[model samples]
Structures are given as structure tokens and as C-alpha cells.
Target: MRSIVFASGKGGVGKSTVTLNLGLTLAAAGKRVVVVDADLEMANIGILLGIDATPISLHNVLSGENEMQDAVYAGPNNMRYVPASLSPEKMERLDLDKLPSAIKKLDDSSDFVLIDCPPGLGPSAVAAIKSAKEIVIVSTPEPSALADALKVRALAERHGVKIVGVVLNMVLGDRSEIKKEDFETVMEVPIIGLLPEDVEVRRSAALQVPVIIRAPGTAFSRAMRLLASRLSGEKLAIQETKVKKGLFSSIMEFFGRIFGRK
Candidate 1:
């Protein structure tokens, strides 16, 4: 199995969101994908997948209360995810040393294990990085985010972890944003993907579903699919009919109409 940790140097760069969407996209293509929410403090993959009600989480596994397999939960698009507990009490017992072993156990059954690492180069983030064989850095197209991402790249290099590439998220075509070429030159890594600043991403997050499933036709989803394809080395074709407009879309449309918006 290939273990890849999706990381960022700073928060609000949408690393977790990117990880969830890519995991789902790979799972939808029939790959055996497992996403682990390694962000102990701010664990939100369960919320994003709408599986927050799960009692067993990564905290249980890390605390030695349960096996890793016991915390695995089925997620959307045929993906399996290991969510971290939100309970403050459980977070305290988390043993970072157990993390590498927990991640190792999933290698036999998974084609790709995508770990949603915590932002910044903290202890938890370093543990997550050490557990994975490779890393994918996620950052926005801005100077501050890029600068922080450079630190992450340096961390990855220090550990001798192979960097697959960098993903540029929340890219707006405005002149103020750093160009793709400049980002590559600074990070010393090729750009793997570029996700635009799309409203659908926010709408899907508010609805607690992946944008690819909530609005498959949106630009964000298209770019996400392309990103997944590049990583998996397979063409992940768009399937809009797979996800129909649901109550969330209806409600948003109602509000849009009432507010005289598109």
C-alpha cells in the first residue's frame, strides 16, 4: 500500500478538505482507499464525511483502548476512514508513539492510505509525516501560505520523506496571487494540482458532504477529479448523474432566489 500524508504548514489552507475529496474520488474509481484523520486536536474528517457519530475513533486506537480495525468506518464513495475522537478526555490519552504502528496495520488492505495531517510542523504533524512514506503539500496561492509551505517542505526533506508534489488550493486568478511558476521555483517541487476558489466547495462543506458528491458539475469538483487522476495515474471521469441535486441544493437555491442572487 502507498501511504501519502496530505500536509500544510498553516491552517485554513483546506488540507483536510482536499484530503477528503481526493479520498472519495479515488474510492469512487474502485480503488481501496483509506483516509485517516490524524489531526488530533481539530479532527473534522468525521464531520466532513457526516460520520461524526462513530464512537470508536483514532484516539481509541492510539490510546490502546481498541485496535485500529475497530475504529475504521465506512464512508461515502466506498472509502473507509479512521476518524479521530472529538472528546477532550480521549484526546488527552492519545499516545503519539502508537501512531506509526496504527498506520502500518492498514497497509495490507489499502491501495492508498491518505492521512489528513495537522497543520504546521508540530509533534502530531511530525508523527503523521513519519508514518507515511510520501507527502503531498497543500497550500493556497499566496505569499504567506507559500512561505509556510516552504517550511513544511524543508521538514519533509529533513526526514528524508519523498515529496510527490505540491497542490495549490483556493487559487483565484487575480493578479495578486502568486503565479504557479513562482510557487514551483520557491518550493522546488512541481505543481500537481490547482483548485479554484469555488463557492461550491464552501456550500458542500456547510452541508457536510464532499463537493464532488454535492455538486459534481462544479469547477471545484472537476479540478479535484483531475487532481485525483494525476495522483492515481488513471483517468477519473466525471459522473454528474451519480450525484443528483438534493435538499441542500434546493434550500440553497431558495435562498439564492430570495436574495436575488444566482
Candidate 2:
């Protein structure tokens, strides 16, 4: 089994979102994928997937109240996931050092164990990184996000972890955004995927469904599937889907329709 961690140096870069969608995509393709919400402190994978409150979570496993298998829950697309508890007390008492053993136990039945690591180089993120054999760094096209992504790449290199590749998310195609070539040059990592700034992404998030399922033909969804196929070492003949309008353009069109403007 391959253990891959989705990490970012800063929050709100869509690390968890990407992890969930990618897991679902891989699972749909007949891979036994297990996604673990390794962000112990601010765990939101459960909430994102609309999973009900469970009696067992990663917190239970870490605290020795239950085994890692007991915390496993069935998620969308037949994917299995281990969600972290949102309780502050549970987060405070979590033994991060035990994470490696718990993660190792998942290898028996999984083809890919994707960990949604917390943002930054915190204890939780570090533990998740140490547990994974490979890492996928997620970042936006903005300068600040790129800077943070470089930090994450450095951290993985320092630990001798293999970097699968970098995923550039929320690509608006604005001239101000950094070019893909420059980003690859600066980060010293190949770009595996580029997801556009599509409104479908926000709608999927609000609906608690992955965009790959909610709007499969959208630009973002297609990009996600391509990324999944690449990671799974499968060559896919995915057709290019044109993005009609970006998030901002769509918003402006909404107001234009309201005012009856051409």
C-alpha cells in the first residue's frame, strides 16, 4: 500500500477538499482508497463529507480507547475514511507520536492511504508527514501560497520523503498570478495538476459532495480525474473541457442578469 499525505504550509489552500475528491475519484476507479483526516485540531473532513457524528474517531485510536480499524467509516464512492474528532479536549490529549503505528495498520487493505494533513509545519502536520512515504503539496497560484508550498517541499526533502508532485489549485488565469513554469522552477517540483477557479467547486463544497461527482464534466472535475489517473499510474484519454466562465465572471453575470444588462 502506498501512503500519500496531502499537505500545505497554509490553510484554505483546499488541501482537505483535494484529498477528499481525489480519494473518491480513485475509489470509483476500483482502487481501495483510505483517506485519513490527520488534521487533529481542526478536523473538517467529516463535516465536508456530511458524515454523522461517530462514536469512534482518530481521537479514540490515539487515546487507546479503540483500534484504528474501529474508527474507519464508509464514505462517498465506497471509500473508507478515518475522521478526527472535533472536540478540543480530544485534540489536546492526542498522542501524535502514535500516528505512525496507526497509519501502518491501514496498509493491509488499502491501495492508497491518503492523509489530509493540517496546514503549516505544526506537530500534527509533521507527524502526518513522517507517517507517509510520499507527499503531494497543494497550493494556489498566489505568491504567498507558493511561498508556503516551497516551505512544505523543503520540509519533505529534509525528511527524505518522496514528493509525488505539486498541485496548483484555484488557477484564475490572471496575469498577476505566477506562471506555471516559474512556479515549477522555484519549487523544484513538477506540476502534476492545475485546477481552475470554477464555480462548481464552491457549489460542491456547499453541497458536501465532491465536484468530481457533483459536476463531473466541469473543468475542475476533469482536472481532478486526470490528476487521480496520473497518481494511480494510469494513462487516461481525457478530453479537454472548456471553462465557460470563471468564478468572478459567473458572479458578475449573475448580477447582470438581475439588472437586465447585456
Candidate 3:
């Protein structure tokens, strides 16, 4: 599996949201995707997917109490997930040395392993960056998120991890004026996608579904799908797909109503 970790040094920048959406987009295209919640302190990917945290989790796998395979929970779009432990105290005592073995098992059977890492420069986040072949940094358009994103980007480079690109979330209305040149200058990495701030994203999560599935046609969904395609080595065909109906067309209609026909 292609190992990619979604990371951000700052919290509340929507790292897990982006990771899960990308996984769902890829899985819908027939890829075997597995999402691992390496964010030990605040593991909410399962919750976002309406999955209840089980007794067996990442902590158990890392502690050698159970095989990683035994803890994976199946989800929609042929995607699978492994939630972090319910016990934060026990989670703090995670064995980093055992992490690699558990991740490798996920790699063996899946087409992609998307890790949702914890926020900050903690051990769990570091271990995830080490395990990743490529890191997709998720950040918002806000200045604080940008500063933290740069720090995370530097950390990934220091570890010799390939930087896949940056995903800009919580975008403002009308992304047309958000110059690509400006973003690249500030980020100093390829701006792979820009997810507009939309209620659809949160509503999709509330409904236990990926935004890409719910609103594939919006500027946000199109950007997400484009990112997934790029990761899979496919050329960006945003316009052609945008011109098509059904999948991509459905979501944009709803988005237009909310953002004043943007």
C-alpha cells in the first residue's frame, strides 16, 4: 500500500477530516484503503464515521496485546479503520518500537494506508511521519495554521519523508481570487487542493459519510477528488469531471445555495 500520513502541527486544522475524505475518494475508485488513527490523544476519525471505539485499538496493537489485523473496523466505500484506545492514560504508554510492525501489516493488504496523526510534535506524530512514504499536510487558510503547517513541513523534510503536498482547508468564499502563486509562495509546497468552508463537510461527517461522496461536484469536492487522483498518479481532469453530471453535479447545487451561488 502507498503509505501517506495526514499531518498538521496545529490542532483544529482538519487533519482527520481531510485524511478520511481522501481515503473515501480513493476507495470509491476501487482502491483498498485503510485508515489508522495515530492521533492517540484525540482520536475522532471513528467518531466522525459513526464508529464506536472498541476495547481493542491502536494501543492494544502497539502493546502487542492483539494483532493489528484483529482491531481494524470495516467502514463504507470499502475503507477500513483502526481507532485509538479509549484509555488516554494507557495510550500515553504506547510502545513506539512496535508501531512499525503493525503499520506494515496494514500495508501488506491495502492499496493505501492513510494515517491520521495527532496534533503537535509528540512521539505519536513523529512515529507516523517516520512510517509514511509521503506526508500530506493539512492546514487552514488562517495565518496560525500556515505557521504550524510550515513547521510540520520542515519536520517531514528533516526526517527525509517525501512531502506529497499541502491541503488547504476552511477556505473562504470564492476561491477564484486566492491566487495559486500566493499560496505556493507562502507554503513553499505544491497546493494540492483547497477545500472551501462549507456546511456540507460537517454535515457529511454528521451523517457518517465522506464529503466527496455527498458533494462530489462542489469546488471543495472537486478539489478533494483531484487530490486523490493526483496521489494515484492520475492526471488532473477537473474540468471534464466538473462538466459531468450525477456524482460531481449533485453536491455543487447544495453548496451554491449556502454560499450565495458561488
Candidate 4:
């Protein structure tokens, strides 16, 4: 299972929005995807998805009050959603030790586990990072968000989790101060995606639907789909692949070996 955690240091960086869209995109592509609202403090992920039923909140799972399956809610398009509890006690009193097993169980069943982590590098963020196979840093192309994103990148590298890549959101596409290329160079990680600032982003969130599902034709959705493909290891004709054929010499050898038996 591919465990992808989406986190940001500052608020309103569109981290949750991206997580929602990414989940929908993966599910649309036939991947068995599940989203865990790891942001236990301000877990409003259910709100964005229009999930009014409480079902089984994360509080129950972590507290041993219920099994992980009990907390899992099937979302729109059959995507599974695990909402975070707004209860203060659950956030403060919940034991971190029990989290690993419960979360691992979820990961084992899902093809892609997308975590909507809380803002800031707090205990929740640390715990999410510790459990994930890879971390995706989301930022809004602003200095404040960018700085925090760099910190998250460092944290992922320090913790030995692969920094899958950094995602730049709310970009203007022509912004002078925010060049997408500089992000990769400075952070020492690949820039997996660059999402433009679109009003549909807010509207989709307001409607509890990911932009991809709500407006698949929009530029935002297209960019997200491209990102999904890249993350899934899909090779596009234009994108560069690591293993080059060395200008045809290796290819000739492969062909030669196949037909040389004749």
C-alpha cells in the first residue's frame, strides 16, 4: 500500500483540498483509496465531503472504543473517509502508541492511504509523518508557507521517510516571486505538481466535493490528474524516465538477444 501524508506548516495552504482531490482522482482511476483525517484537532475533512453522519470517528479507534473498520466511512464515489474528531479531549488524551497498529490495518487494506494531517509540525504531524511511507509537503507559494514546507521536507528527510515531492498550490502560473523551478532546487526534492489559484477550489470545498469530481474539466483537475499519474509511476511520452536506453545501444542488445537465437 502507498501511504501518502499531506501536511503543511501554515493554515490555508490548501493541503486538505489537495488530499481530497488526490483521493478522488486515484479512486476514479480504479485504485482502492482511503482517506484518514489525521488532523484530529481540526478534522473538518468530513465537512468538505458533505459527510454529516458521525459514523466512527478516529477517537473511537485510538481509544480502543471501536475497531478501525467501525470508523471507516464510505465516501462519495465509494472512497473511504475516516474523519478526525473535533473533541478536545480526544486530541489531548488519545494515546499515540495504539495509533500504529490501527492505522497499519487501514493501510494494509487500501491501495493508497491519503492522510489529511493537521497544520503545523505538532505531535499529530509527527505521528502522521512517522507512520507514512512518504510525505507530501503542500504550500501556497507564499514565503510563510514555503518556509514551513521546507521545514517539513527536512523533517521527512531526517525521519528517513521518502519526500515523495513538494506540491505548490494557489500559484498564479505567472507569478514573479514564485518560480516553480526554484522550489525543487532549494528543497532538494522534486516538484511533483503546481496547482493554480482557482475559485472552483473554494467552491468545491464549500460543496463538500473535490474539485476533480465537481469540475473535472477545470485546469485544477487536469493538473491534479497529471500529478496522480506521475505519483502512480505512469510514464508519459514527454516526461523523462530515469533508465535511459543510452541512445539505442542497449535497445539493439535487447533486440539482438531476442532474435540472435535464430
Candidate 5:
């Protein structure tokens, strides 16, 4: 199985959101994908999926209260996910050491195992990083964020974990934002993806649905599909969406054309 961990140096970089959607995209392409919420302290995969409560989670497996398979739950698009417990009691009993073995059990069944690691260089993050065969750093187009990512890259290199490039999220293409080449130059890792900030993503998360499922034709979803194709080495089809132009659309188009703007 391809064990890939998605990590970030700083929080609020959309690491969990990108990881979840990528797993779903892979699953949609007919690959057996499993996403594990390894961010034990602030596990939000369940919240993103609109799952308020689960009987068993990663905490249970680590605490030896349940098997890894028992913690796996069904998700959309035939994808399976291992959500982390939100309970403070379970968090207290979490055994980070057992995480590796617990993840190992899923190797036989899954083609791809995507771990959503916690931010920073904490013990939990280190444990998750060491457990993965490869790591993908997620960052924004900011020096501060990239600086933190560099630290994570260093940590992964120290452990000899293969760096699978970086996923640059929430790219707005503003002049103030760092260029792609600069990011690569600073981190010494290629940018594997450039996910744009889309309002649809926010709407989907509010509805407890992934953007890929809720709005596949949107730019964000298309980019996600392309990213999945690049990783899977298969040219997955991009779904095209047709829009009906109304009076509002015509007016906007006319103004956009006149002003040479969107």
C-alpha cells in the first residue's frame, strides 16, 4: 500500500480539507483509499464529514480498546476513513507508539492510505511522520507557513522518509504572494499542487460534503481531480459543467469584457 502522510507546519492551511478530498478523488477513480485522521489532539475530519459522534475512533485502537478495522467507517464515494476521537478522556489515553502498528493493519486492504497529520513538530506529528513511507507537505503562499514547512521537511529528511513534494493550498495568485519557484527554492521541494481558494469549498464543508462531490465542475474540484490523476498515474476524466447564462450573467460578461476583468 502507498502510505502517504499529509502534513503542515502551521494550522489553518487547509491540510485536512485537501487530504480528505484527495482520498475521495482517488476512491472515485476506482482506487481503494483510506484516510486516517492522525491529528489526535484536534481531530476535525469527522466534523468536516458532518459526523458528530462515532462509537470507535483512532483513540480506541491506540488505547487497545478496539481494532483498527473497527475504527474504520464508510464515507462518500465508497471511501473509508478512520476518524479520531474528540473526547478528552480518549485523548488522555492515546498511545502514539501504537499508531504505526495500527496503521500497518490496513496495508493489506487499501491501495492508498492518506494520513492527516497534526501541525507543528510535536510528538504526535513526529509519530505520524515516522509512520508514513512518504510525506506530502501542505502550505500556503506565505513565508511564515513555508518556513514551518521547511522544518517539517527537515524532520522528514532526518528520518529518511520520502518527500512526495508539497501541496500549495489556497493560492490566490496575488502579487504579494510568494511565487511557486520561490517556494521550491526555499523548501528544496517541488510544488505538486496549487489549490485555489473557492467559496464552494466553504459551502460544501458547511453541508458536510466534499467539494469534489458537491461541485465537481468547479475550478477547485477540477484541480483536485487533476492532482489525483497526477498521483495515481492515471488520466482521470474531468467532469464538465454547463452553465445557463441569464440576464445577470450577460450583464456581468458585458462589464467584464469592457473592463478586461472577471
Candidate 6:
């Protein structure tokens, strides 16, 4: 399987969100994709997918209590995933060295395995970096976030891993944010995708579904699908459609319009 690690130097940059959505999109395209929640301490992928209780998790697999296959769960769009546990106790028992071997075993059955790596250059993140053959860095257009993303890119280079590309998430089309050209110049990497700051993303997370499935027609979702297609070696022409705004989104836009009139 082609192992890809989705990583970020800073948290809340939507690394996990991008990982899950990309996995789902690939699965939708008939690829056997498995997403591993490598963030052992703050394992929120399960929570995000509304899978709060799993008898076997990545923690169990790492601790040698269960095989990696035991933790695999069926997800939306025919995707398979191995979610990490949220327990602090499980965190202490994780064998970081076992990660690469465990990931290797998955190669026999999957077309692609996407690991949702934790933020920063911690042991867990390093383990994920070592396991993955290619890396996809996730970041926002903020200067601080881009600076941290540069650190991650340097780390990947030090380990001699190929960087698939960078995914710029939550773009609001504001002048305050870094431009795509500037971001690419600073990181020395191509921008594979630019996901918009759409309200449907927040709504899908709240509803425990990927935005690609919940709002497939939205600009953000279309970008995700195109990214997946490119990664899977398929050049698909994806067209953006109007976002189906929810009541909360409507309220937010209304308030923004009123505030701007002053």
C-alpha cells in the first residue's frame, strides 16, 4: 500500500479533518483506503466519526494486546479505519517502535493507508514519519502556522521522505492570510489543495460525517475530491457547486453583513 502521513506542526490546523475526508473520497473512488488515527493521546477521529466505543483500538495493537486487524472498523464511503484510544492509560503503554511493522502488515490488503499524525515533533509524530513513505503537510494561511509547517517539511526532508504536497485548509480569501505563491515559495513545496473556509465543514463535523459526504457539491468538498483523485493517479475534472448553507451559516453571514455596513 502507498502509506501517506498527514501531518502538521501545530494542532487545530485540520490535519485529521483532511486525512479522514481524503480517505473517504479515495474510498468513494473504489480505492481500498484505511485511515489510522496515529494521534494516541488526543484520538478524536473516532469521536469525529461518532464511533466513541471500540473494543480494540490502535492502543491495543501497539501494546501487543491485539492485532492491528482487530482494531479496524468500517467507516463511511466503504472506508476502513483503525482509531486510537483516548485513554491516558493506553497512551503510556504504546510501543512506538511497533508502528512501522504494524503499518507494513496493512500493505497486503490496502491500496492506500493514510496516517493521521499528531502535531509537533514528538515521539508519536516521529514514529509516523518513519512509517510513511510519503508525507502530506497540512497548514493554514496564517504566518505562525506556515512557519510551523516549514519545520515539519524540514523534518521530513531530514528523514528522506517524499512530500506529496501541502494542503492549505480553511482559506477565507482574506488579504490578511498568506497568498498561495508566498506559501509555496516559503515551504519550497507545491500546494496540492486549497480548501475553503466553508460552514458546511463545521456542520459535518458536528453531524459526525465527512464534509465530502455531507456537502459533496460545496467548494471545499470538491477540492477534497480533486485532491484525492490526484493522489490516486486519476485526473478528474471536479466542478465546484454552491454551498448549502445551514441556519448557523446564514446567521453568521447576516451578522457579518450588518457589521460591515458601519
Clashing residue pairs found in predicted model 2:
none
Q: Write the per-residue lDDT of candidate 2 for residues 1-262, one digit (tens) a residue.
A: 9999999999998999899988888888778989999999888787677555578999999888899999999976778999997667786567888999999999999999999999999888999999999999999998999999999999999888899999999999889999999999999899999989899988877765567776888998888998988898996444332223332234335335434566
Candidate 5 lDDT for residue 144: 95
How much lDDT does candidate 5 score? 0.87
What is the lDDT, from 0 to 100, of the residue 150 in candidate 6?
93
After superposing candidate 5 on the true structure, give the runs of residues whose Cα lies further than 4 Å from its correct spot: 237-262
Please name the candidate that would achieve the greatest lDDT relative to the true structure: 1
TM-score per candidate, chains pooled: 0.91, 0.89, 0.83, 0.85, 0.89, 0.89
Error of 4 at 130 (Å): 0.6
| Model 6 regions more than 4 Å off | 236-262
The model with the greater lDDT, 2 or 4, is 2
- Taking every candidate in turn, the Cα RMSD to the unseen true structure, in Å, is 5.8, 8.3, 8.2, 16.3, 9.8, 8.1
Which regions in candidate 1 have their CA more than 4 angstroms from the true location? 237-262
- Best-performing candidate as measured by TM-score: 1
Per-candidate count of clashing residue pairs (backbone under 3 Å): 0, 0, 1, 1, 0, 0
Question: Candidate 4: which pairs clash?
Answer: 48-208
Report the Cα lDDT for residue 262, model 5: 77
Better candidate by lDDT, 1 or 3? 1
Cα shift from native, residue 35, model 2 (Å): 0.4
lDDT of 2: 0.86
Residue 71 lDDT, candidate 1, scale 0-100: 89
